[model samples]
Target: MECVWTRNGSRCGEAASRRCDRCRAVGYCSLSHQVSHRSIHKIECDRFRRQMNRADVLSDFPFTFYVEPSKVQVVSFEKRCSFLARHGVHGLGMWICECSCGSSLINFDTISFIPDWLLSSELCPCNEPSISLQGRLSSWKDYCEWRHLPLSSPAAVILHWPLTVYWAIQLATGCNLLPEIKNELRIHYLGPEKELLQLAAFGELQALFPGVRIYIDFVGPAIPDRRSDERIDLHSYALCNDTACRCKTEMVSKSQAVRMQLHAGFYHDRYGEFSK
Candidate 1:
């Protein structure tokens, strides 16, 4: 039987470097990818091997991961904490988050954000305070170490400010069950104290179910009424927070492209300074 390694809906054929003699199910295209994956794969490789040995894989059916907008929801977290009636979320709920990696668990209030459609101008209500990226990297390194994640492996960054909303949505749509599913959703909130508030359990699920397709679809482009753009750079920029502010580039900057690039770095350093 041919060995197949599928992650986050992306497929990698049997590579000499990835094959594990002990577990025939999981193989990587390169030793580095396999080595980086050992943290999670080591625990589940045995089970996956047993399944593969049974000839459970369907031939001619290439593995795939799917991401669809309907599966995700964004909620409001700030509202639930505010005392002023007008400050909190109109409808708020509490929730708890657990890392499928068995690393840690967190509890907090939650809310949901529903995209306009494939694309929409969604507002963000997070702390607009400035921070130092260098400092953030210091702390994030600790968090990653604590969680046993590869320092170089892709990791998601979540802000601590909008805890309630992020938590609520995360609970509603547990993390992705496959690597591909997990990779599709990379959302970020702007705030200091970057605390990986939520990620679709993408890494864990991918490690556990290598063959499953994971998809997280957000209502973005293709919606006739929504001017959502697949190219984030084209999205309009506006203040996400409710705070009043001028539209000056320094006082206030908006660019989907810039924001997207920052998203990855933000996870690495939750609260770091941004230079113009």
Candidate 2:
């Protein structure tokens, strides 16, 4: 980790030996910088602390990932990064935007103007429709009943990518798209990456927009040449722990709710084709 405090448009960048006493998520090279950055850091520090202390942060799941003994319980993105670093894998796409070189700005190190959509834990199926969420969400218990997933499932950690896009759509359309565009929904999901591998995560979108024919265009360089411009159809809801709910008869006859197409190029390079 490196010092988060910036000096003269440049980061201190020195090895951060001192961490914020309250949140412990941010660090500084020295006591002086820590004190100097306190006023600015206080707002986010409080938020980080509150999120870290939430009851759901320490949630355990039935998955083998959680069943195995871990040195530390994976909670916040900061500790999650540290845990992954121990195994020689950098935690990309968590607490920071994915990049080829390295992370900056919205990265966990600085925490400046970090997107609340990525951090908010209250984006669940709750009582307050106006303040929390609309009927777009199914209860965690209900979701688990269908999915056989635990209520406190850590799947959110991985599912945040597509969820963020859904959140952005809500913000962009003033959350009125449900009534405005009812049957067919086309989402141009730009800059796709690891999402290309785990298409099942998009299944959650069905819950978000029930009975809607959702077409997703995953346009990015991550798509291999062999797979580009190929349309893959998802015939049924994502598979769950329950095999009794499905049978060979149903699997072969099901129609797709979510349809995906891969385009292996940067959006800018393929703008001519997409513009049409």
Candidate 3:
């Protein structure tokens, strides 16, 4: 005669006379409790109805309620190629979904790339790639053009300086030069352009921190080492230049910001380096 449902951190153990109208198997002391439990009880009620309707006694197949599947269509292989061609994305060698907006490409591997609210809609108008595509494409194009230049070339230094400093920061302080500004912060390589790379990094840091005297180490190779009196790496606290690093390899192929955070933790504790 006691209510089967638990309520307010305790069992409803009161006398019960009302049974669930559908299953008639469970009872509740109050109508509120019954209503609150309906969402859960409906599942069991549906199962019970299914079991009752089955005519074959020997059939051991579990009862399953039929629900219509979503009608969203997956893009066909031919359509995918056409979409890629239209967008000028060639030879990526990966499966990508052209977001319904026709403005961005979404790699299938990034499962969480689509937000939950967007997932519920019939089509996802992913605007992130569209917004960032031009900037990234231009950056890559510039990188390719300057990539083969000698590190001492003024052109290479001017173009790839931001990226070089970004990596130096990562190696020295274990912190990424840029953090949390945008989604796509991949650093493109401009070869081994080391001329004035350290000076350029120091200048960038000084500009960012104004009045903070930063120092660069020229021993062996030119790299930003520390501020005049501070032992801490300047890159650790410097505002990320929003440029990508180039030294990153597939083994640690995470966003530059995330990878640097991991590196920072590793330097401090010596145990957090990413493992395969």
Q: Which stretches of candidate 2 lie over 4 Å from their true place?
A: 1-73, 77-151, 175-179, 245-256
Give a tens-digit lDDT track for model 3, residues 34-138.
887777567567645553444243132111111111111122223545544543432221112222333254322222111111111112111111122222212
User: How well does candidate 1 score on lDDT at residue 31?
Assistant: 71
lDDT of 2 by residue, 23-73 (tens): 777788999999988876876687567545543522432222333233222
lDDT of 2 at 170: 55
TM-score of every candidate: 0.22, 0.47, 0.18
Candidate 3 global TM-score: 0.18
Error of 3 at 143 (Å): 83
Model 2 TM-score, 2 decimals: 0.47
lDDT tens digits by residue: candidate 1, 1-276 = 222333563334454454666776556677766675577566667765765664542231111111111111111222222211232321221112212222223221221222111111121212122321222122323323333433322122122222232233343354332133332334333331112222221222222222333222123111222222222321222222223433112222221112222222211122222221
Segments of candidate 1 deviating more than 4 angstroms:
1-87, 90-229, 234-243, 247-276
Best by TM-score: 2
Candidate 3, which ten residues in sequence have the lowest lDDT sum?
113-122
Among residues 3 or more apart in sequence or in different chains, the pairs in candidate 2 whose N, CA or C atoms overlap within 3 Å are: none
